[model samples]
Target: MENFNPDFLEEENDDLYEHFTFTVGKGQSPLRIDKYVMGKIENATRNKIQTAAKNGGILVNDVPVKSNYKVRPLDIIRVLFTHPPHENLLVGEDIPLDVVYEDDEVLVVNKPAGMVVHPGHGNYSGTLINAIIYRFDNLPNNSSDRPGLVHRIDKDTSGLLVIAKTEHAMSHLSMQFAEKTSEREYVALVWGNVETDEGTVEGNIGRHPKNRLQNTVFLDDEADKGKPAVTHYKVLERFGYVTLVSCKLETGRTHQIRVHMKHIGHTLFNDERYGGDAILKGTTFTKYKQFVENCFKVLPRQALHAKTLGFKHPKTGEFMRFNSEIPEDMQQCIEKWRNYSKYQELEE
Candidate 1:
């Protein structure tokens, strides 16, 4: 690797790019090369980063390294981002979106379940970001092409989302989310009956110690501690074993609803990561248990959904609210509960 100024790496580009170099920071050792690069680069997808590493785009101390190579202290890392293939990159598909409202400054859409917000990891195309890119000609040229994304819901979580069309709108909307002035609500069918009607779970959430793919609550104070998160939930209906609850997020954290509910002993139905299996076992209805197990075979992700979003419009200064009905899979879960009640009556 030549003596390239790191400052040149920050230059804006509308075309292909070359290799960029960065140094491994202290206490940042023992991370996979791809994972390390993902943390270092803003808005770069993991798959793209990994692809670059595999093709000799990433080098350590002037020697090419694999994606899985672990980093040591003071390692010189270089990443070359080759322009992605035209088909693999995010492009506007002519997919019809349920646009709830649209204006010059902002747009609101009822984001469907199973649509990822942005390209990442295994998902590189057919995302909401791609759709927005297709719909609008001039997108904000920020770190990512997703200019107006104020916040995001999980891929399998369906709900209302606001997109800012202008840079000013994006800035104000992002500020609202940071200040916790925006209202976000979700409806989830959690395993196990919530003993309390309404309660708040306050904790710090960070990456899980053992599981690299999941987040966990950290109770103790640490140097690089997790951010403070609070969630208030109220049980809407109880099915003797499982319960339908409405969750209000005061602080947005990754997997906030799913993890916080689990931390309080009621994990979401069919959530594979936390304590979902225990709920399947505790239900009195054996048939229902078998049904849930079978459903898990088909439903690979968690059964949590974002149902409502409320925020003040950045440009118009008007309060905006949007709501979406639960998706079919979640509705099926509720139907199973109803059938469980019928089965119990027949048994009696």
Candidate 2:
């Protein structure tokens, strides 16, 4: 709500690309997405922009738009390319990976916090993809030319991910995700106490027009502007000021859990971009503020983790399920909150 860290947000890359973002000027005339982009960047032809749009790299307000989509005033547009601004290719780095499961067809990895899933413009190295390329050989490239990648988690969120090693494996895994047959579950610490033990939040999610870095739920007639997303959550613990919840996602839209929880008045704890850094539900006391600050220092990023992943084996047709533990930072933060809630101390 105040300031956003763009560098952190850009760390989550669905594809390895250099993304250029634009905010339409108030005085600018309305134009198609392709023509508008061509005018803004030199050496960018309309056809080239159209091609990028066809590839779903043209985003308006975080929603993929076609080349003919009209760009309105104040729309946030992001144009992405497979290469960097300087056209440098991706390089592999020898980053250590926490391989939970691996075989000839697939590999399941527990990705740590602060690690990017793939390379981007400003982030071209030290990504999980880079590590995969370095550690393995002959990984079939996806449509984006990213090898061994089927899906990705956020940069700050610790999680389990399944990587495909062969073309047949990639196709099988991607189809499972596309048909919503895969199962993904997350553990999130959110602000406030969730009244219900379990519930579902279904909404269309898109970019916030004013805040380009954040996404919001689009409802009513505006729901068509965004894509359908569904998240079902249940309370795990009540920490007074914060609640720990387990979320199962039916749809995997970008920032689905974060925005959906916030829509229901339970933003993920310590989610800086979503206003969870502030004390949203705690007492107005110096001690409470200091306690929360200590928790924030313990876990600097959003309190969300992809705890479980289940899917059919790409090659063998056997169902496989994987789960990861909560990272140290999040575990320590939860302990601190648990102690605070047990004592019920609010005075300075």
Among these predicted structures, which one has the highest TM-score?
Answer: 2
TM-score to native of every candidate shown: 0.76, 0.78
For candidate 1, list the clashing residue pairs, or say none: none
Q: What lDDT tens digits, residue by residue, belong to model 2 across residues 182-259?
A: 999999999999989999999899766566567899887675556789999999999887999999988888789999
Residue 310 lDDT in model 2?
98
Stretch of 10 with least lDDT, candidate 1 = 8-17
Query: What value does the lDDT take at residue 226 in candidate 2?
Result: 63
Cα misplacement distance, residue 221 of candidate 2 (Å): 1.6
Per-model lDDT = 0.76, 0.85
TM-score of 2: 0.78
Q: What's the residue-level lDDT of 189 in candidate 2?
A: 96
User: What's model 1's TM-score?
Assistant: 0.76
